[model samples]
Target: MAEPFWLVRPRHDGGSDYVRFLPSQEAVEVREGSHLPPQMPLLKRRQWLPLKEAEDCRRHLQQEGGFRSSEPLF
Candidate 1:
């Protein structure tokens, strides 16, 4: 079985408007709860592709031109 990947959409402003990329169903449950870490935000994850597949896909995108050089270091 392949692991699942999610498309995390971070909350722009306040309120509830974000997404996350999780690994497992159990992880989803844990993520859904409001007991996450302090630094971590309260955004939810939207599953997109399998983890294994996503890994390969991400790698391919990076190898090609989908990856960015620098992502604005906070």
Candidate 2:
């Protein structure tokens, strides 16, 4: 399987939004809920986006400091 792009952010309801790309489906998937403890993976709410829109969303989130790079700062 191809690698997927992933992102995550917190919600005002003390939950989280987990975003990932589904390469096979060629779309971005968003999962919203409390990520830990009480999360129901099978029942979590979801949204979908096109690749271009998803990339744009990621860029916007990064600008807001909601996403961080894995690379270490030298």
Candidate 3:
């Protein structure tokens, strides 16, 4: 069986709903009558990227062009 079955709970205005993940089966289940909250965002699979990849992307961006959005950009 796959490990680390996560349950995504959407937090909204005043309530929350749950969405479960079955990693072993690669399935996702949305509960009934569970309305999506406005405050909570819908997370995509791409959003759950590895830290190494994120760091690599950051490094690449830094190399391409350092943070220039600020007045005293580095």
Clash list (residue pairs), candidate 1: 3-51, 19-44, 20-44, 20-45
TM-score of each: 0.31, 0.49, 0.26
Better of 1 and 2 by lDDT: 2
Q: What's the lDDT for all of these models? A: 0.35, 0.55, 0.33
Q: Per-residue alpha-carbon lDDT of model 3 for 17-66, expressed as tens digits?
A: 33222232333232222334454444343333344444444345445633
Which window of 10 residues has the lowest lDDT sum in candidate 2? 65-74
Q: Which tens-of-lDDT digit does each residue in 1-74 have in candidate 1? A: 22322222223343222222345643331122111333454434334565566556545644663342222111
> Poorest 10 consecutive residues of model 1 by lDDT?
27-36
**Number of backbone clashes in candidate 1:** 4
lDDT of 2 at 52: 75
In terms of lDDT, the best-performing candidate is: 2
Candidate 3 TM-score, C-alpha based? 0.26
Best by TM-score: 2
